[model samples]
Target chain A: MKINPEFVTSVITKFIREELNKFGFNRAVLGLSGGLDSTVCAFLAVRALGQDNVLTLIMPYGQTFPQDVEDAKAVVSLLQCRAMIIDIQPMVDAYFHRYPTDNPVLKGNKMARERMAILYDFSAREKALILGTSNKTELLIGYGTIHGDMACGLNPIGDLYKTQIRQLAIWLGVPEKIRNKVPTAGLWPGQTDEGEIGLTYEEIDKILFELVDLRRSRQEVIASGFDPKKVNLVWEMIKRSEFKRRMPPIIKLSSRTVGHDFLYPYDWDK
Target chain B: MKVVLVQFSPHLGLLDKNLDLHYQFIDRALEEKADLIIFPELSLTGYTLKDLISEVALNPRKNNQLNRLKSYSHKIDIVVGIVEEGNPGLFYNSAVYYSKGEILAIHRKVFLPTFGLFEEGKFFATGRNFKTFPTPFGQVGLLICRDFLHYGASYCLLAGKADLIIILSAAPGRGMSENSGFTSSEMWELMGAAISRFSTAFVLYCNRVGFEDGVVFAGGSFIYDPWGKCLLRGPDIEPAFLSLELELEDLRRARKTWSFLRDDKPEIILNSLQNLLAKNED
Candidate 1:
C-alpha cells in the first residue's frame, strides 16, 4: 500500500499516547542509537507524551563509533528531551572476560541484551515504559536480539518498514544527517543492517509487501520478476524467526491452554 | 450531513473508562461540528465479555450511566453499541440511536455468531427485526458487526428507503496479504464500497482497536459515498476520529444513475426463501 508519512506519524503519535495512558503511564523511555528508527521514535514520543515525560538513553559499548554518539546527543538537543549516557563496556566486558570467546555474533547479542538491562533499570527508576524502536523489516526476519532490542513496554514503530520509518523520520523533523546515514544496530564496527541481512531495505520491503502483506504465494512472487532463490530465502527467514515473535508454548494438558483458550485481560485488575 | 467515526479501543469490562472516553469523543466531535457520531460494536461494554456479559449489561430506562449520553444527543445524533438489558435477565447485543434526548431506534444484532472465536450466541438473545428510522440526515439503517456481513440485512434497509447505512464492528484483523496490508481491512473496504455502489446509499464503518483478551480489533474505520468512493479512512491499528462532509445529493445521484433499488426483487426473494425452507423441512 502507499504510505502517507504525515498520516502515519499522527496515527503513531496518538497510539503512543493512548496505549501508554491505558497502562497508567505518562512517561516514555528508549535507547537512542542516533539511528533513524530511534530518532523517529523519540520524536513521536515527545509529540505524544511531551518533552518532559520522555527519557532517551544512549548506551555505548567499547567498540561504538564516535559519530553515532555525537548524533544521539544532537538528536536529544533537537528534541529537547532528557538524555543520559551509560557506558555498557564494563558489563559486557566482565561477562566476556569470564567466558572468553572470539565470536562477534555472541558479543553483539550480549551487548544488545546488556543495553536493555540498563534501560529497564532506568525505566523502573523513572516510572516510564520502555519504548521499542525495532521496525517491521528487522522484526520479521529476526534481525534483532530476542530478549534485548525486542523487549519493550510499548512499540511505536514496530509495524512500520525501515523505508517507511525513514520517510516518517524525515516528516517528523529528524536531523538530515541521521536520516541520510546508513542504518545500523550499532552492535559492531562497520555493521550495517542491509549488509548483515543480505538485501537492501527497499528490495526486502517490496518482497515482504508482496509475500506477507499481499498474501501472494511464493511462486507468484518469483513470477513477479524477483529471483526465485531470493524470494524463497526471505520466506525461510520468516518461518525460522516465528518463535521470536511469540511467547513460549505451554503443554496443553487441560481443556483451556494458557495462551490458547485460557486468556485474561492484561489490565484486568486496573 | 456530517458524520464522525470515533474509532477507539474499549477495554473489556471497563464501563466507567469506556463511558468517559465516549463522552470525551462526543465533546470533540461536537467541536468539529458533526451532525452524527458513530461508535464500534458494544462500545459501552466490549466485544469479549463471555461470562461477564450480564454484569455490565445496561438497561436504557434505569441505567444512569447513559444519562449523560442522552443529554449530549440533544445537540447531535449519537449511534453506539450497548449490551441492552431487557426483562430482568434477558440481554441483547444492540445498537441504539439517540437524538433530541430520545431513543429513536435500537437495532439488536440479528446474527449471533457461534462459531470460531465468537460466542455471542451463548450470551445474548438474537434480535428479530431490522428497521430504518427517520434522522435529521435522512432515513438511516443500523447493523451491528456480523449483521452487516449478511446481505439480507442490507436488503431490508434498502427496501425501507434508507439513504444511509451505519455498521458498528468489533472485528479482529487477520491475514496480511503482501500488497494489500491487512486482509481483513481490505475485505471490509471492498464490502463497504460494493454495498454503497449497489445499494446507492452511504456506508459508514466504525471498527474498534486494541487488545481484548488477546484479540486485537482492527481499527480501519472509514466512510464511503454512494458512488463507492472513500471519503476518509483511518488506520488499521490505532484510535482515530474521522469527520466527513456528506451531502445527500451523492445518494440521489447514484440512485438516479444506477437505479438498482428501482428494479424490484424482494417479492421474488420472499417466494424463493419459502420454497427453500419447505424443501429443507422435508
Candidate 2:
C-alpha cells in the first residue's frame, strides 16, 4: 500500500512529541551509524525535539570504515545538533583480550554491545532518552544484535519496513549519499544486510506487506506468484525472531505475574 | 453503487479546519466517481468534547457550514456527522444525509452513552425517531455512534425497508487479542457482517482515528456487501480513505437466496412487545 509521506511525517512527529511530553522529558539521544535507518530516526528526533535537545553519539570500532564515520559527521553537521564520537576499539579490545575468540559473529556481537554500553552511559550523563534505529525488516528476521542496537527507550522507525524507510528518508530530505548507500550493520567489513538476508528489500517488503499486514496464509502467498522457498524462509524468520520483539518471558508462579494474567498499562497514572 | 468510506483524524473543536478537510475528502471522492461518501461520527468536531458540545453545535437554518457539501452532492451523495442545535437549549449528536442540494434525512443518535469514558448523554438530547429515506441508489438508513450498537435500531431500519445501513462511530481502540490485534475493531467487523447477512442489506461502517485527551479513536472503517463479504477496509490507527464499486444486485441476490426479509414476522414481534408492555403496566 502507498503511504502519504506528509501525513506520516506529521503523525510521527506528533507521536514523538506527545510521548516524550507524557514521560516528562524533552531531550532525546540516538546512535547515529550513518545507515539509512539510524539517519531517519535521528532526523525525526531532531524535528520532534529540536536540534538543541537532540544529541547524536557516533561510536565506531577500530574495524569500522572511515567513510562511515565521515557520513555520520556530515549528518550531525547538517542537523546542527550536538554530537560526540567515542572510539570503541579500546573497550572492545579490553573485553576480547580476556575472552579471546576467532569467530566473527562473536566479535560483531561484542562490538555492538560495546557501542550500546557507551550509548547508555551518554544517555545517563546527558539526561536524554535513547532512541532506536532498527527497522521492521531487521527486527522480524533477527538480523539485529539483541540488547545492543535493539535497546532503546522508544523507536520511531521500528514499524517501518526497509522499503518504507527509503521512501520516508527521501521525503524527510535526508542526504542522498546516506540514503542511497548499501544497507549494513557495520559489524564487519564488506557486510551488507541484503546479502546476509539473501533477499532484496523490495522483494521482502512486498512479501512482508502481504504476510504481516494482510495476514495472508503461506499457500496464499505462494499462489500469488511468490516462490515457495522464499515464502517459507521469510515465514520461518518471522516466527523464530518473535522472541526478540517481546520482553523476556517470566515464569508465572502466581495468578497475576508481570505480563501475565494481571497487567497494568505503562501510563496508568497519566 | 460506488461508495467511499473515510477514516480521518479530526482536530477537536475546530469547525473551519475540519470543514476544509471534509471538502478535500469530498473532492477526492468526486474524482474517484463515488456515488456515496460516508465519514465517521462527529466528522465536523472530534469526539471527547466535554463542555464544548454546545459551542460547536450547528443550527440547521442559521448555519451555512454545510452548504458547500450540499452543493457538492449534486454529483454525489454525502453522509456526515455533526452536532446539531434543536431548541434554545437542546443539542444532539446527529448524522445528516445530503443529496441534490438538499438535506434528505437526519438521524440523531438514539443511544447517548454516559457511563465510563462517554459523556454524550449528559450534554446532548436523545433522538426519538428511527427512519429511512430514498436515495438515488435505494432506500438508505443512517445511525450515529452507539445507535448501531443496539439491535433494535437495525431492526427498525430493516422494517422501514432500508436496503443500505450506514453507521458512524468514534469507538476507541481497546484490548489486543493474543493472535490478532485491536479486539474492538474485530467486534465491529463482526457486527457489520452479521447485520448485513441477517438483514440482506449492505452495511457501511466508518470510524475515526486520532487522540484527544489521551483517548485514541480506533479507525477500521469498512464496507460489506449483502452476503457479508467485505469489499474494502480502512487502516487502523491511521487516517485513510477507501473507494469501492458495489453491485446493488447483491442485495436482491442475497435476499433471494436466504429470503430472511420475506419470512420476517414484524407484526408478531410488535404484538408481543405490546402485550409485555400491558402486563408490566398492570
Candidate 3:
C-alpha cells in the first residue's frame, strides 16, 4: 500500500551489497555524473560499501556545465566519500581535432567513451568494482553511449525506468536542483534532452511503459496514439543496438557457439 | 536410484526401428540393475518427421504402444519421447515419463526453432512450464533440447523441486564452440551448471547421433553431478549408455562445497530473466 522512495532505495542498496558480497568484492567505484542517475547510484554504493569503500570520481570536460560540477561536489561533500575530479577537455579536444566531425551524436559518443577509459584506468588503480549508472530507460532507448556511460563492471539501476530514476533520486536525497535539471548528458551547449528528441521524458515514459511493461503490441501502441513513428523509432533503435546488449555475435566455426549455434551461458572451463 | 541414459540414434520416420533399439537398450539397462532408462527427444520417430508426425501420432485413448510400455514400468521407470496424440490438428513432441504401470508425466518441447536449418514450429507447440515427476531418488524434471536452454527452467527446478534433470535431446550440433560459439559443449556445461548450482541433483542428457534431414546430430551425451561436475560424457558420434553412481553423500558433499540454491537471488534472477526475455521479444 505504501509505495515510497526510501523503500525502493533500501531494497536496491541491500541487494547491491549482498550481490557484491556474493561476488567476493569489497569496494566499488562509481562515476559521479552529478546527474540524478549517477547520484542515486553513488548513494546506493555508499550503503553497499561504506563511504570509505566506495570511491567517487568526477570527470568533467572543461566545457561541461558549471552546475554539473557543483552538483558532483555536493554529492561528495554530503556522502563524505573520497572523490577525484579530472578535467578531460584537453584530451578530448585533441581526439576531436583528429576526428573532425560536425556530428554532435558522434562527438558526444567519443566524450562518453573517453570518460569511461579514465574510469576504467581509475578502477584498475583502486581495484574497485566499476558500478554503472545507466537506467533501464536510457539503456532500452540506446540513449547512453556504449562502452562509455554504458561501461561498468556491474549495473544497479539498469532495470529501473527513467521515471523510476526520478523517484529513486528523490529517495536517495539527491539535491533538488540536480534532480530537476533537464536530464542532460551535458554533452553540448544550449542542450536539453527533449530539445533533440522533440518529446519529453514524461511522454516517452508513458509510451515505453505501455509498450514494454504492459506487453502491448505495435498496433495496440499505435491505437493508443503513442505515435507510430516514435514507436517505430524506438523499435529500430533497439534492433540496431542489440549488438550492444550482447557479446560480439558468435562467428560459429565449431560444433556449437556460445550464442546461437550451440547456445549456453555457463563457462565450461570452470 | 540408478538412472540409465539411452543415448541412441533414431532414423527418420522409422518408428519400429527406433522402438526396437529402445527395447534393446531397456533390456540391457534392466540387466545392469538400473532403476530407470531414458531416451532422447522424438525417440519413437526422429525430429525431421515434420508434418508426417501428426499422421503417425498414436491416439492416446486408442493407443496400444503406451499401454505396452506400462507393463514394463512395474520393474523400472522409463522416460521416452513420444507424440502425445492430441486433437486431429494438434500433437505434442512430448517426453513421456512412465512408471508403476502408467504414464508418469509428459513434457512438450517449448523453444521450437522456426528459423535456421530446423523448422520444428511447423510440427509442434511450445510447453508452458517445467514439469517434475516424483521418484524414489528425487523429483525428476524432463525437458527436450531447447527447453533446457531456457535458464528459467533452472530456477523452477531449484525451488526445492527436482533431484534429477532428465533431458531427452536429438540435440543438433549447431553454433557450439569451445570458446565463443554455439556448440554441444556449451549446452552440456550450462545444463551441468544449472543442475549443480541449483541443488543436489544429477543432470542426464541423452542426445541422439547421426544426420536427420541434413541436420547433424551431435552425439555428445553426458551426466553431471549436483556440483555441476561431469560424472560422465559419451562419444560424440556413438550410441552409448553413460552412468554415474549417485548417493545421498555425493549430493550432500556438493551441497556443502557450494550451496548455490541457498545463495541464489531468486527475486533478482526472476527479474533478470524477465528483462532478458523482454529484450529478446522486442
Q: For every model shown, what is its TM-score relative to the native structure?
A: 0.77, 0.59, 0.50
Note the B-chain TM-score for every model: 0.96, 0.96, 0.87
Candidate number with greatest DockQ: 1
Measured with DockQ on alpha carbons, how good is candidate 3?
0.01
I-RMSD for candidate 3: 20.3
Question: For every candidate, what share of the true interface contacts is present?
Answer: 0.04, 0.00, 0.00
lDDT (10s digit) by residue, model 2, range A1-79: 4555665566567667766675677898889888889889889998888999999988888646899899999999999
**What lDDT does model 2 reach?**
0.84
lDDT string, candidate 3, A1-270, tens digits? 012455445445655664455446778888887888888899889976789999888888884577788889998999998899888888889988887889888888888898899889988888787899988777777777878889988788776777778876776677788788888877687787777766677777777777766779878998988788888776676677776777787677877556655422121110
- Candidate 1, residues A1-270: lDDT per residue as tens digits? 456676566556776776677778899999998888888999999998999999999988854688989999999999899999888999989998999999888998998899899889999999899999888988888888899999988888888888888777777888898899998876578988889888888988889888877789999999989988778878999999998899989888988777876655464623
Candidate 2, B13-49: lDDT as tens digits: 7788888999999999988989999989988977777
Q: Please give, as one word, the docking class of candidate 2.
A: incorrect
Arrange candidates by DockQ, highest first: which order? 1, 2, 3
Better of 2 and 3 by DockQ: 2
Tens-place lDDT digits, model 3, residues B158-257? 7646778888888776542223222545656676766665667778888886554334566777888777777777765556786655674666677677
Q: Report the error of model 2 at residue B272, Å.
A: 15
Give the DockQ-based CAPRI class for model 3: incorrect
The best-first sequence of candidates by TM-score reads 1, 2, 3
Q: Pick the candidate with the highest TM-score.
A: 1
Query: Which pairs clash inside model 1?
Result: A209-B178, A213-B177, A213-B178, A214-B177, A214-B178, A214-B179, A215-B177, A215-B178
- True contact recovery of candidate 2: 0.00
